[model samples]
Target: MRKFIILSAFAATLFVSCDDTRKVLHEQYLEYVMHTDSLDVVHDAMTVHHDALKTDTRTLAQKLKDVEETDSIAIADLAKHQVLLKEQATSLSKLKKLIESHADVKSYFMSDSISVEQMEAQLVEMEANNTDIAARLTQIKTELKMIEAEQESLKKTEKH
Candidate 1:
């Protein structure tokens, strides 16, 4: 009887702490995942438009390693990730097409011999793409901040 009572007390203490502690870790992981997602298009749109990025390749590729189910702790922040995933993927495809279309421009830049007309055309294309990419990044960043704040709050509560 005494052993049973001791075990019960121990279990109770463990339950309360573990419940919230787990929530904290889960929330941290969720934000990590969300930020990882927001970076995909942001990075692609900016300084990292390499060949691999043309396909399903970005920093978030790791966070999105598996997505069969979003309810798990691994993907708790699934909805945002899903939306960003599709939008970023679409953006990436469009960006790749834009870049591919400007193959001549890239070659010209590399070759150091381009006509003024070609430069103007490339400039226009870049301006349009830059605007679109900026807008998408703004949206993703806003969503990411919101989720990050929520995760922070959850962590603080868990600490107590």
Candidate 2:
């Protein structure tokens, strides 16, 4: 009777151990899924930002051409546009870096050996970072549009 009791205790311990491991594995899988979803959102936002960047760059180029063609404009006005162009270029460089760094989602996430809690923390942090980057990209694009519109108005005034 004593031996039977000891064996039962050992079996219960093993069963509880297995259950714990399985629970952790399940949690890890869910974290991975959430991580993937966050990455997808980031990718989509970045793509939209990239397209806007391209369009804004083309607008800047056209504005530069217009500024060069018109001799009536004040040097100060041209300089302002030039400075805005430079700022836009700098912002584009930053956007490119952000995109390149996060484009490879696989490297950002670990599939094995990481604890569930760690994975959740990492995912939350990444989502926050991506959100910030998306906001910056949107701001830059809006600034570019405003500058482009101002330049267009300047051109119209010069023509009149």
Candidate 3:
């Protein structure tokens, strides 16, 4: 009877240990899914911002070409702004590529070989990168707005 009691207690403990391990794994899986979803949202936003930047660059280029010869100063300023815009676009494109390369979230999540600590470290790095990208996008948007305003001011001066 004592042997039976000991065996039953050990079996019960083993079952609980397995159940706890599964619960922890499930939690980790959910966390990984959330991180992937967040990344997707950021990627989508970056795509929209990138497209807008391209459109703005084209518009600025057209304005530069259409400006009157007499407005050399305005043309020079517009040309400078266009150059800046091109550089930003290039940087953004590179960033987008980087993000694309790191977008294999599913494979990483599904792999049993990867340790939890390693996955957590990767998530931290990705979050930091995402933050940097978001800040750069905001800065680019602000600069674009300022350039557009300057162009409008130039147009007003031309009318006079």
Identify the superior model by TM-score, candidate 1 or candidate 2. Answer: 2
Rank list by TM-score: 3, 2, 1
* lDDT minimum window of 10 residues, candidate 2: 102-111
Q: Candidate order by lDDT, highest to lowest?
A: 3, 2, 1
Residue by residue across 46-152, what tens digits does model 3's lDDT show? 55765675576567557657756547777777777778777776867876765664556647644666666666666666667666766776787777677777877
**Winning model by lDDT:** 3
All candidates: CA RMSD (Å) = 30.1, 6.1, 4.8
Which digits, one per residue and each the tens of the lDDT, describe model 1 over residues 1-160? 9999999999999887765654554444344334444444455644333232323223333434443432345244444444555575566567546544533344453332554445445555555655565576576456545544644543444344
- Model 3 misplaced stretches (Cα beyond 4 Å): 1-69
Which has the greatest TM-score?
A: 3
Provide the lowest-lDDT 10-residue window in model 3.
Answer: 28-37
Model 3 misses residue 106 by how many Å?
A: 2.6
Tell me each candidate's TM-score: 0.37, 0.52, 0.63
Q: Candidates 1 and 2: which is better by lDDT? A: 2
